[model samples]
Target: MLCRNCLRATRAAASRPAIPLLRAGISSVTRSATYTTSTQASVRHTLQTRLPALPTFRTYSTSSSESAAPPPEKPDYLNEAESTIWDRLVAEFEPTELVVQDISGGCGSMYGIEICSPKFAGKRMLAQQRMVNTCLGDLMTNWHGAQLKTRAP
Candidate 1:
């Protein structure tokens, strides 16, 4: 009984708020930025292409061959405490490279030890570190903390 134009007029009822239709052509949005000296409302990262490239199948390196530089000689310039820890690690692991530093300034309370040894060659990283900690014995207790890095030769 109803005409086509009459049916279309009843569809948009009065209770609902009308949603404006979005037309095309906006290519970018303008953002309000604040000074670095003042508090910022939000921080956004806009650089997309500068990120590390997607990895190839089963390959991680960006280069053809990774020829690493040889490590430095066992440093003789270490203070007495650093040398003692270095000596113990050298004897136990027979490390190809070792660097020990007193990271707690002049206090000798904390150490940073990086050791690369053939003993670590076949082991997982966590196991190699556990081995180093075990070998350090009571030396582990005397320090407030240590930044220990162990790797296979």
Candidate 2:
């Protein structure tokens, strides 16, 4: 008598159902059998073998109380041009405190500024100076010059 397995194999050979052979060491069978074999290469290409999902990033927003109010606007005595340049520098540096002294009268339109910013952390003195210079590109063009003193927070 013919074997049942042999009969099944004969039928399968006559009308073979499409099957996919994945790269060695990968899944033996496609996730869905109904998908055509042409998709197998793409499937294999796209499928990521089981791996741990990356940790999601979490962001926390600060309440007004959590952060201090912005610094009071500079006094009226401060030159408008000087104040504008100072405010831009302070905002760029996010300094603990910035002091801009206009020595322009003595030094021919030159100002001395001291900046303290957490952003300056780990940078060399030259790099810190360059950072301030880069931020003040527009202001620098208008003013005759500046003296930068930067400190890391």
Candidate 3:
């Protein structure tokens, strides 16, 4: 330990500044100092040289056998006769708001209706629905089921 060269090396190490120790799992970006452009470029080059190239992908061509017809258009939920139910209710009730949905999965057997009208202001829920049923007439018999929700304007 008394050797001149060893003594010089120890003095040199003691004179050098201390580096802050990085904690485990800490990100370098959150450090106080920012990297220079040269440092960033060197890092980019190193990463590019180290990583393997991705496999090239090929484009596919559709053959005549693989080409099929486009899908058929979806069928209408409410046909002309089914749509008239809304019109009849509108004509009779003069509702401020009306919405009718065919919930029969395109069979047009069941309908859900929401009607808001001044006419329903003094009427009970059953009476309001009965009026709608009466307006539907023979069409009501044709329909398998209906859900009626009424509101006063």
Best by lDDT: 2
lDDT, each prediction = 0.67, 0.69, 0.67
What tens-digit string does per-residue lDDT give for candidate 3 at 100-124? 8888887878889888877788899
TM for candidate 2 is 0.49
Best by TM-score: 1
* Tens digit of per-residue lDDT, candidate 2, span 9-111: 3456446564544544456653343544455445444454543467999999997566744554566777776787778876777677678878878443788
Candidate 1 lDDT by residue in tens digits, 1-153: 334652342243223443332223222422223223121111112222334567778855654234443434668789999888887887788777888999998798899999898789889999999998998869888889989898996
Candidate 3 lands at a TM-score of 0.47
Q: 110, model 2: CA deviation in Å?
A: 0.5
Query: Of the candidates numbered 1 and 2, which has the greater TM-score value?
Result: 1
What is the TM-score of each predicted model, taking all chains together?
Answer: 0.52, 0.49, 0.47
Which order, best to worst by TM-score? 1, 2, 3
Clash pairs for candidate 2: none
Better of 2 and 3 by lDDT: 2
